[model samples]
Target: MTIAIIGAGVAGLSAASDLKGAGHEVVLFDKGRGAGGRLSTRRASTPAGDLRFDHGAQFFTARDTVFRALVSDLETRSHVAKWTPSRVSLAHTGGTWSAEPLRSDDDWFVGAPSMNSLVKGMAEGHDVRWGERAIALSIRDEGRYVQLDTSGWQGPFDAVILAIPAEQTRELLADTSPVLASEAAASVTAPCWAVMLAFDAPIKTGWDVAEVSNSPLSLVVRNSSKPGRGNDETFVLHATPEWTRANVDKDKEKVAEELSGVFCQMTGAGAPSLAAAHRWLYAKTETPANSPYGWDHAQRIGIVGDWRIAPRIEAAWQSGHALAAILID
Candidate 1:
């Protein structure tokens, strides 16, 4: 069977890996320049030096047997390592508390060098098209799946898996699967603005990660402290969903300026040496689909992501694995 998995993120890559292991020929496609959708990392110029920031899905956890096995393999290659973060959660009522949920001796992990490396390692020998955008998905007259890309229509596959966000998959599959479309469309997503800042000199921020409250920012993470990143006082400041929604259409520079000022005030990090901003329009799903994955019974189209289950890397991997198993069975 020829299986087409859309979105080279964790879920898509995991599905492709599992399907191939089951003796099915698989092809993975992603619109991003690199794999690992939310699992992104980038280098930025700073006075101190070049710093790396994981601007997307920060870190991942292992919960399932398959994911554990995969992580074990990644660990062997030095593509991932354990990370203990000092997490602080803010209460809705304006109270704050620090906990060690993210700091574990045995259950936390981050991609070595960068989170995207894990996906790159997973996609070693797969047929992955990094810059290809899947324009359409359909079931042909003859019981076969077909995917339309920017170049042309390519298909005649036995099965298709969509591992992107629910909203995006909904847009592509609505014509062929109204039921799947309706369900996915109903699952609204939250947005977030990540403000990346680089400092010229080391700032005296006592903690590596700080959870903020009653402000536009949600969490602030010190990127330089991560295991595999370079040594520079760089930070990733994430805005609250409410703030991101309110300022979605505003100019990027203005948003960056405003957030940088707020971050300096919050942490007393001083003026940033360099700054950049990113908007995750579908940062996470507002509501879950009550299942780990979505499938069109008659169309042979399957959708899976963290939004399909819980909002986490582990959930995304598990959802993809389950969907591929069901499709290949």
Candidate 2:
């Protein structure tokens, strides 16, 4: 069966890989220029040099057996590496800020060069239509079809899988399958504001990653501290969901300035030579779907994403893999 999988993120790529491996023809479509939805990287030009930031997901852990095996294989292929950054927890106390050491036994893994490299590696050898947004879906007498924003309607595939965010899946399924659309609607997601900072001199914070409390910012990472990243004294700051939702409409420059000030105050870092901010409307999953994946046998339509389980790369992989397993069965 020829399948149309939308969204070239981890979930979509995972499904496509498995289905194609099972002797089915699978094609993927994404609106972005490349794969990796939340597992993304941003490049910034600075006087020091070109800086790379894993601004989306800092790092991911593989608990499931299947995901662990895949990660082990990627590590052997030089596409991924274990990240052991010095960790710290910061909290605001009575007129003072306190920092405590954070320790975890669970292994953390990141893409060798950038977070998106993981998905790019998984998306190898697949027919992926990049820079194409699937705006609508149609059902003909032959099979299901998808309408791309640029390339008209394409398909007559046996099945159509939505591997995008919950809201996006809901919108796409509203007309095709209302029941599946309602399932997508049940999942809730939150927004995030990310700020990338590059400095002329390195900030001597001692710790590479920090989890903050009682602040607008949630997590701060020294991007250069990660493995395989060049030495460029770069940092990525992620704002709290509440803060991001409140300031979602603010100017990007202003958002960068405000977050930069917070970074300086927290770490005593100097003004960044380059500061940029990005707004992610569907950044984090607050509530997930009831099942691992949603499938409507009558319409041959399905939905797979991290929002169907937990907000983790492993969950996203598992969701897609689970859907493909059922379909193959």
Best by lDDT: 2
lDDT of 1 at 39: 83
Q: At residue 284, what lDDT does model 2 achieve?
A: 86
Tens digit of per-residue lDDT, candidate 2, span 268-310: 8888999999999998899999999999999999999999999
**Over 4 Å off, model 2:** none
Q: After superposition, how far is residue 140 of candidate 2 from its true place, in Å?
A: 1.5
Candidate 1 wrongly placed segments (more than 4 Å): 46-49, 89-106, 143-149
lDDT of 1 by residue, 78-112 (tens): 88887776665443343333333333445778888
Alpha-carbon lDDT of model 2: 0.91
C-alpha root-mean-square deviation, candidate 2 = 0.9
TM, every model: 0.92, 0.98
Model 2: which ten-residue window has the lowest total lDDT? 42-51
Write down the worst ten-residue block by lDDT for model 1. Answer: 94-103
Best by TM-score: 2
- In angstroms, the error of model 2 at 327 is 0.1
Q: What lDDT would each prediction earn against the true structure?
A: 0.81, 0.91
